[model samples]
Target: MSEKNREGKRTARERMAAEREKHKAAEKRRRALIVGASVVCVLALAAVIGVIAANAGKDDSSDSEGPAVAPSGAQGEDSLVIPVGKAGAASTLVVWEDFRCPACKSFEDTYRSTIHELTDAGRLRVEYRLATIIDGNLGGTGSRSAANAAACAQDAGKFVDYHDVLYQNQPAETDDAFSENAKLFELAAKVEGLDTPAFRSCVEDGTHNSWVAKSNDAFRSGGFTGTPTVLLDGKNIYQDQSMTPEKLKQQVQEAAKG
Candidate 1:
């Protein structure tokens, strides 16, 4: 009850109060840190999911069994090579292409007529192999869909006509236009006897989707890197840019002489 005793007790009480406030502030800071870290982790996980969703279509060609169907006269499991001429022609030309590829459009534009001329003369046989690498690299289903439709056209015995029309109306590589089945049917109307209900069903049903996959598998199996890959008798003519359209004709002619 003395004055000194009272003052000592009051000072002790003040010290304890100050210590409790410090502990409370430290707890609040720890809780805030934990909350902030949880928010960051949640945001990071959402970003990863978004990336995966964006790339889902890019892996469509990963099926190792190839497509559920293949075009007629498919060579092994790698391609359904639609032939353009007599089976026993003197020269065999194999061409690999992606329908959405600009380079392929250019190649076809330049040499399409010459190829037809030779094929008609029974001097050369050409085989077309489809590829969808553009779809994998560019993140869309246009290439695969277009190739499938092309194979479907083959089923109707109008592969040559439909193939020509596709390149003739090919959209820019970045447009991803061929993903639309309506567009394919619209283009099919340009080819004779190709716009029937059966053709519509085939294209819309994606009846040749498996064929597209098989063709893509064949493309990979061949170990080539890009589209418009032209080979004469299994020899890569464009390996070093040594072959132009004229050069291709000459090579085929020379091969015929022997």
Candidate 2:
């Protein structure tokens, strides 16, 4: 080959190598970003394989700041559940959820319509057992406080509305926006009569704070190692990769017919 051609080929190879190095650098940065984002919400759990989740319980205890005043109409053991849907519904969806959990919000966003439809049709009942794992793990009272606010809404016969509002306006995974009663009240205002004096008092007094703590304790002790642990008819359906909203609705309808 000509000397000029040889020189040009060598330059082209060097340029190609440099481009490859640049691509490798970009991929490294991308992977680092992904891993860092996951770390914000992942907690290692014993006895669970490949279970990525926010903390179910950290070393610190939940905020047990008051007496365990069960919200009016709450059911289940220790009055830990805020029940929604009809009393005679055939299937019960037991949800161990954290208000501060991003995953919980995602689940709600995905399945809220189907859940509401089933509940409205009286085909499904939901037992929402709130947990404060984020507070216990991430050093904030947002989880417990938000759950308390939702309980307070239950007193006004508007738990589902307020619950949806909170998740709809959920903050970033690490942002503890729900720690403030003012924020809770602000959101409650969007739920029509939910921002009433009684509701505010219930939230301010933390009437169900102890109940929420008890519920969180149950979650940690239940050997279920994640937030948003959704059980349909006593089966952990959230782990089912094929479980979609339509599938869930069909299952509930079938159960209702049985």
TM-score of each: 0.81, 0.76
Please, what are the lDDT tens digits per residue for candidate 1 over residues 145-256? 8888888888888989999999999998888899999899899999989899988888787777876776786777777979989888988775747667777778778888
Model 1 TM: 0.81
RMSD of 2: 16.5
Q: State the C-alpha lDDT per candidate.
A: 0.83, 0.88
Off by over 4 Å in 1: 1-18, 21-67, 239-242
Candidate 2 segments whose C-alpha is farther than 4 A from its true place: 1-61
Candidate 2 collision pairs: none
Query: What does the lDDT read for residue 79 in candidate 1?
Result: 48
> In candidate 2, where is summed lDDT lowest over 10 consecutive residues?
45-54
